[model samples]
Target: MSLDQPAPPAGQDDSTGREFTSALEDDDVLRAEHVSKRFGAVTALVDVNLHLRKGEILGLIGDNGAGKSTLLKILCGFQRPDAGRLIVNGEEVQLRSVDHARALGVDAVYQDLALINQLSVYHNMFLKREKVHWPLLANRGMRRAARNYLDEMGVNIPSVDAQVASLSGGQRQAIAIARTVYSEAKILLLDEPLAAMGVKEAAIIMELVRDLKRRREVSMIIIAHNYGQVLEVCDRVNLLQHGEITLDKQSKDTSVQELNDIVVEEYRRALEQRQRAAS
Candidate 1:
């Protein structure tokens, strides 16, 4: 954003009024302002403010219990914040449930994938929202749609009719993502999508993510432990620590080594603080 360009009026879009994927062109599709959440006496988040651009992928990184999961749950409508607001497409909206978030084009694919191993790829793709044609189900239509969607997205799988259990880890991950994409989700929250995959499988998933980003089909928030991979795939990266976002930088502006050093230093400082408090 240029200093001379001036700011958009309060709660109003600028004169551009166009949508595009480039960091230079797109508008913020999602915003969380002064968000806070707590579990019992534990504070999970503290006045956190974050935003997702219309077509960029945002990487979320944090150590355990750093409020990452809590924020994700709130964004997905699996949980609500004790304070602050969630703005979608510039409108302040309350997410009543996961279904409500989905209706507003926000969806999440957790690490578990939420897929039934016994079900076929196509079956899982159209789960809960199946197509019908009067007396019988539109199995043929669904199969075709699933196959085409996967193909278009460059997700390689042997057959749409094949059981998900029979597919490789990468294929299964692709299926999970494809299901969300097919649902027409505009913003996708992918929690640890690359977890527990071998190099080849991880590469495949990375390619799939790149393909999605290339197409500008959706804005994404990806939580991952691999800082290198996150930097490789995301447009911007944010670090959550002590229930707040402590660092935010464009991927092009930072490196994995730098990020790691920052995290390590933070951990050292925290350890010293704890030791001092104990004394």
Candidate 2:
């Protein structure tokens, strides 16, 4: 749904005509209720419920097989849940495909970035949906739009015509993000956006994220392994454990030590379970 559309309560808009803005001050733009998914005999998610509020960054953190990617894929419409419903802007929706999710103002930037190395920055910006003038791609119009978008996002690059392969890692990441936001994405899913970056480069991405939050135009869900970075950038953090969200807390309400304690306790429980089975 477009961010500008007035939000109504899940069932109220049809009956009482109440606005969604009146639902809650921290309105949930997206919600996954009792979502579950499985592959073969393996359960990937189990009744996982999550909510992303408007204009806030939510951090999804967990160990390697903690179902973070699985849930992210479901949210991005790359995979459908075996059970449960997806609510977008207070209405239930069945996302048919990635394009459907994008049309609903949902987009994701995976770790690979999906950028064509040989393509120029401007070309990549307008990759999927290029501006067309009659029978030709409007190169000039696209270039101008790309420049303005990059500038608006505070991304510093030498030239929009430069090949992505020639840019630094941080610059490439920024360009990928700019392209997504330029497409009018309201809920952005970012998978490890700060991975494999130097201190300064990571800082650049963090600052950009902070700026995005300040703009309050897009809500975000960032997947990262770094707890410190998650606390620094996200307003709230959700820890996925055993295929479900076991921890959800405001960044300020939780600390690194507390987060570590939870992981340690989980480890101990697993060890005890294994010992009991062996006995």
Candidate 3:
């Protein structure tokens, strides 16, 4: 039973291969165990266990009703899990609020690319953390800091004074990402971020992701429609079906066809098992 929740964001209307084997050797960032949720008679998730490691990407994929967003809401502290728990950085903690997630160094970026339309790049940069003097916002200080942050990330935005509404899709994406990282987000969750972007733009985003991981200070979970994109950036892939994780494989060991075949077979087996049970 599917609930009447809002739809997920558009996924790459314009457009991974290998090399994820050793990107993550001994790093673990976020861990979820046996997590489940339900609304009335509809069960959104069940027995979902996933581990996201530091300095590498983890991919989450499944068909539409497979509860990807539901799981994300739970992780982002928008919704509470009806069962199981999460362990962060080896510590058992309850994410009772979004603040809890933020406190735990976790941050999520939506496909909408949340940014203030009327605000300049510099204002958006510091946002709530803008430098202030005598209870007044110090514009000069914030612009200087924004410039430094963009330079630090190797992102070349034209001007911090430009409003987000005026930026292109890709540039807006870059700004949003820069803001998240600048805000001290340690664990970043990107939800279909590349959707609606062109190939060149998408490549830029991917490169930025790689740069962030190379910095080794932030871990990320990237959600994409194509297995190739996931395989390209993710150290590991975790596939979900009917609320359960059906496939958890290292990107180095599996091909996209193999991933699809596993899902198809698992589905076929489920049908057969149900028929036998009915008989």
Best by lDDT: 2
Worst 10 residues of 2 by lDDT: 17-26
- Steric clash pairs (candidate 1): none
Order of the predicted models by lDDT, top scorer first = 2, 1, 3
TM-scores for the candidates:
0.87, 0.87, 0.81
Count of clashing residue pairs in every prediction: 0, 2, 4
Ranking 2 against 3 by lDDT, winner = 2
lDDT of 1 at 214: 75
lDDT of 2 by residue, 5-98 (tens): 6755576666753333335433788989899999999999999989999888999998889899889989989899999999887778999998
lDDT (0 to 1) per candidate? 0.88, 0.89, 0.81
Candidate 3 residues lying further than 4 Å off, grouped into runs, are 1-27, 263-279
Residue-level lDDT tens digits of model 1 in 166-230: 99888888899999888999999998999989999899888988888778569999999999999
Q: Against the true structure, what is every candidate's RMSD?
A: 5.1, 5.2, 12.0
